[model samples]
Structure formats: C-alpha cells, structure tokens
Target: MTDGGAMLPWLVIRQDDNGNRYRVGSYATQDEAQRIADSLGGRGPERLYWVERMGQAAPS
Candidate 1:
C-alpha cells in the first residue's frame, strides 16, 4: 500500500484479541487465511497496520 516501496501485495495485520500490538509483512496474495484477521478487525480491533515485507499465512 506504500506505493510499492519495498514490495507489493502485502498483508496488513495484527495479533491478540484485545486490539493490542501488531505488525505487517508482504504476502503472495489475499489468501483464505486472511479471513481470520478480517473477522478480528470486524470485532473492534485497534492499532491496525499494513505490511510491506514477505510473510506467511500464519499469525503475526
């Protein structure tokens, strides 16, 4: 989302259930696993961020 600064098609995400801390990383694409994070975001998660590095379909 940074206009192709470091990489492209990254996964912007966070961890925990209380909307605490988070991180970002580049992903191949919007894989199905993204649904988990999407669900969390709908629950009032806070401090959301976007990634710009390589990442896997796992927890941040």
Candidate 2:
C-alpha cells in the first residue's frame, strides 16, 4: 500500500502461478476496478486477476 491510493479504495490485483500478488491500480468504484480486471482476464491460464477493496491486508 502507498499514499494517494487512499481515496480510491478499489484495487485491481494480479496473481501469477507462483502465488505472488501485485497491485495493478486503484479505482474509486468496484465496478471500475472490476472492468479493468476483466479486460486483463484470461490472458494466460496460469495468471489470475481480480478486484479487492484496499486498506485490508491479507495474512502473510
């Protein structure tokens, strides 16, 4: 997480086959984030994309 993305709470995330997650970008609405994620979807069988609300950190 970083500064500036605080206002836009929606996150577009990409996870590779190795299970490493990366933040693509942030949006003001979930729909907007999901649209970007969906556009990037299915590019590769091993790559996965989705949207999540920012500020909540997952257990490591």
Candidate 3:
C-alpha cells in the first residue's frame, strides 16, 4: 500500500515485437518503476518498456 491507499499503483509494462504485453513488475513510486523500465530498455531493440499508473485500489 502507498500514501493514498493505492496498492502498488506504479506498473512496469513490457511489449515485444510480436505485440504481446506483459506486466514486468509493480512499484510504490513511479520513479522506481521508470528506473526499472529504463534499465530493461537497453537489452532488446525489439522490446518496448514503459511505466503506467494503475487505478487506485485498496489492498486485500
């Protein structure tokens, strides 16, 4: 859970050349998530990485 009651709202998403998307990871802060995506970007030219903020949802 985070400051505004969102549980791991920051998401790191990856997409490959084949048009398949995957949830690489989740984070409490956007910066942390972006850093991870940036690091992964250099690994493959055909793979795309980005960060997104998911809707706020309370933890179970």
1-60: candidate 1 lDDT, tens digit per residue: 444574345565665557564554445455532644455465543444433334445345
After TM-score superposition, the amount by which residue 15's alpha carbon in candidate 3 deviates from its true location, in angstroms, is 0.2
Q: What would the TM-score be for candidate 3 when compared with the true structure?
A: 0.77
Ranking by TM-score: 2, 3, 1
The alpha-carbon deviation from the true structure for residue 1 of candidate 1, after best TM-score superposition, in angstroms, is 22
Candidates ranked, most accurate by lDDT first:
2, 3, 1
Per-residue lDDT for 1-60 in model 2, tens only?
445645788899888899999989988889999999999997987878888898776434
Off by over 4 Å in 3: 1-6, 56-60
Each model's TM-score, in the order given? Answer: 0.29, 0.78, 0.77
Error of 1 at 44 (Å): 3.9
Cα error, residue 26 of model 1, in Å, equals 11
Reference-based lDDT, each prediction: 0.49, 0.84, 0.82
Clashes of 1: 2
Higher TM-score: candidate 1 or 3? 3
- Put down candidate 3 lDDT per residue, 8-56, tens digits, no spaces: 9898888888988888988988999999999999887698888888864
Q: Report clash pairs, candidate 2.
A: none
